[model samples]
Target: MAAKEKLSGNIIQRSAIFLENIGKRFAAGIEELGYVMVLFVECVYWVLTGFRRKQPVRVAAVFKEVREIGVNALLIVSVLCLAVGVMLSIQGIATLKQFGQELWVVDLVAQSVTREFAPLIVGILVAGRSGSAITARIGTMNESQELDALRVIGINPVRHLAAPVLVGMMISVPLLTIVGDFMGIMGSALFTGTEIDMPLDVYIQRTFEALKPDDIHQGLIKASVFAIIIALVGVSNGFQVGSGAEGVGRSTTRSVVLSISCIVVADMIFTYFLNIGTLT
Candidate 1:
C-alpha cells in the first residue's frame, strides 16, 4: 500500500510540473506576440508623426537601409527568381503538353510567378538577409548600450532605428517582388520558347494576356505586409536581446526564424482572402 501511494504521488508531481511548464511557455508566447503588436503600433505612429515630432526621420538612415535591403539584395533575388522561373516553365510545359496546351505554360508561369512565387520568395529572402541583419544590428547596439545613449541624447530608438528599417523594408520588399516577377516571367519565356519551339513574341504576348492587374497587385500587397512582419519581428527580437554576444546571436537567429514563419503565415492568410472566390 505504501509503495503504491509513493508511485502515485510521484506521477502526480511530475504531471503538475509538466502542466506548469506548458502554462509558462504559453504565457510567454502570448507576451511575445503582444509586444510585437505594440512595436508595430509604435512604428505606425512614428510613420504618421515622426516628421512633426521631436525626432524627424533621418533621411540618410533611410537611404542607407534602402541600399542595404533593396539594392544589395537585387542580384541574388534576380538569379534565384530566374532559376525558379525556368524550373516552373519546365514543369508547366511538361504537364500542359499532354493536352496540346503547351502554350498555357506562359499563363502558368506568369500567374504563378506574379501572384505567388515572386512575393513569397522575395519576402523569405529578405527575412533571411535583412531581417537577421536588423536584429543583429540592433541587438549589438543594445548590448553596447548605444540605444540607451540615443535615448539619453533625445532620439527615440523606435524612430531612429526601427522605423527607418520599417520604411526601408516596406519600400524594398515590394520593389524586390516586382523585380522578381519580371525576372521570373523572363526566365520562363527564355526557356519555354526554345523548348516549345514557339516564338518569343507570342510567348510574351500570351503572358500579358493571361495575367490580370489584380494578379500582380495581389502580390505587391502581400509583399508590403510581409515587409511589416519581417521588420517588426526583427525589431522586437532586437529589443528583447539579453546580456551577451551569445544573446545577440540567439536573437538574430530568432528574428530570421520568426520573421520567416510570420511571412509564410501571412502569405497563407493573404492568399486565401485574396483568392477566396476563385477557389474551386
Candidate 2:
C-alpha cells in the first residue's frame, strides 16, 4: 500500500514539473514574439524616416547588401524551382492519367506554381539562405563588439545593419517568386510537351486559361509577407545571440528554423484569411 502511494506521488510530481516547464516555455515564446515586433517596428521606422535624419541611410551600403543577398541567390532558386516544376508535371500526369485527365496536368502545374508552390519555395529558400547569413553576420559582429562600436559612433544597429537587409529581402523575394512561377510553369509545359506529345502552344493556352489574376496576386502577397517574417526573424535572432563562435552557430541554426516555422505559420494564416475573403 505504501509503495503504491509513493508511486502515485512521483507520477503527480512529474506531471506537475512537466506542466511548469510548458508554462515557462509558453511565457518565453510570448516575450520573444514581443521583442521581434519591437525590432520590426524599429527597422521599419529607420527605413521610412532615415532620409529626414542627419545621417541618412547610405545608398551604397543598402545596394551592396541587396546584391549580396539577392543576386547571389538567384541561380540556386531558379534551379530548384525548375526541378519542382518538372516533378509536379510528371506526378500530376501520372495521377490524372487513370481518369483520362492527363491534360489537366497543365492546369495543375499552372495554378499550383503561381498560387502556392513558387512563393512557398522562394520563402523557404530565402529563410534558409539569407536568413542564416544575416544571423551569422550580426552574431559575429556581436562577438567582436562591432555592434557596440556602431552604437558608440551614434549609429543604430537596426538602421545600419538590419534595415538594408529588410529592404533587400522585401524587394528580392517577390521578384524571385515571379521568376520562379514562370520557370516552374515553363518546366511543366516542357515536360508535358515531351512526355505526352502535347503541343507547347496548347499547353501554354491551357495554363493561361486555368490561371487568373487573383491566383498570381495571391502568391505575390504571400511572398511579401514571408519576406518580412524571414528578415525580422533573422535579424531578431542575430540580436539575441550570446557570446562566442558557438553562440553564432547556434543562433544561425535557430534563425533558419524559426524563420521557416514562422513563414509556414504566417502562410497558414494568410491562406485562412484569404479563403474567407474569397468566400465572402
Candidate 3:
C-alpha cells in the first residue's frame, strides 16, 4: 500500500511538472504572438503605403478577392440567415404572444435580426468559409516556398496576398451583411406569414417601421470590425503555418476559430456600447 501510494505521488509530481512546462511554453508563445502581431501590422501599413505610391495597383486584387470571398460565400450566408430568421421569428412570436404583445414580434424580430444576427451570422460564415480558404491558400503558398521565392524576387508577400484579402474583406463583409439582413427579413416575413396569418407585405412594413438608424449603423459597424478581424486572424495563422500539410489544415482551422472568437468578442463590446448609448 505504501509503495502504491509512493507511485501515485510520483505520478502526480511528474504531471505537475509537465503542466508547469506547458504553461511556460504557452506564455512564451503568447509573447511571440505579440511580436508577430506587430509584424503583421507593419506589413499592412507598408502595403497601404505602397498602394499610395502605386508600386502595384491594388484594385484588381481587391476585385478578385471580393469575387472569390464574397461571391463564393453566398450560399452559406443565405442558409444561415434563413435559419436564424426562422428561429428568431418563431421564438419571438411564441414568447410575445404569451404576453399579449404579439404585435411586437415584428419589432423584436427585425431589431434582433437586422442589428445583430445578420452581421454575426454572416461574419461567422465568412470566417469559416472565406477566411479559412484564405488561410489555407497562404499556408500552402508558404509551405511551397512561394513566399520565399517572392522575397528573393523583391516582391512583398503582404502586399501581394494579405492586403488584397484584407481590402476585399473590408468590402465584402458589409455587402454580405446587407444581403444577409435582407434575407433574414424575408425569412422572418415568411415565417410570420405562416405562423401568425400576417401577410408578407404587412410583416415587412412593420419590421421596417420598427428599425431605427442605430440598428443599421451598429450592424454595419460590427461587420466592418469583423471583417478586419477575419482578415488579420486568417492571414496571421496562415503566415504562422509550419511546413507540413497538416500544418496548413491546422492553420486554416485556427484561422476560422480565431476569427469567429474575435467576432463574438467584438460583438459583445459593440452590444455593450450600443446599449449604453441607447440608454443615454
Which candidate ranks first by TM-score, i.e. highest? 1
lDDT score at residue 279, model 1, on the 0-100 scale: 100
Q: State the lDDT at 170 in candidate 2.
A: 87
Which candidate number would show the highest lDDT if scored against the true structure? Answer: 1
lDDT of 2 at 34: 97
lDDT of 1 by residue, 116-234 (tens): 99999999999999999999999999999999999999888998998899999999999999999999999999999789787888888888899999999999999999999999999
Worst 10 residues of 2 by lDDT: 54-63
| Per-prediction TM-score to the true structure, in the order listed | 0.96, 0.95, 0.89
User: For model 3, what is the C-alpha lDDT against the true structure?
Assistant: 0.86
By descending TM-score, how would the candidates be arranged?
A: 1, 2, 3
lDDT of each: 0.93, 0.90, 0.86
Please give, for residues 109-188, the per-residue lDDT of candidate 2 as tens digits: 99889888899999999999889999999999988999999999999999999888888888889989998999899889
Instruction: Tell me how far the alpha carbon of residue 38 in candidate 1 is from the true structure, in angstroms, after superposition.
Output: 1.3
Q: Which 10 consecutive residues of model 3 have the lowest summed lDDT?
A: 48-57
RMSD of 1: 1.4
lDDT for 5 (candidate 3) = 100
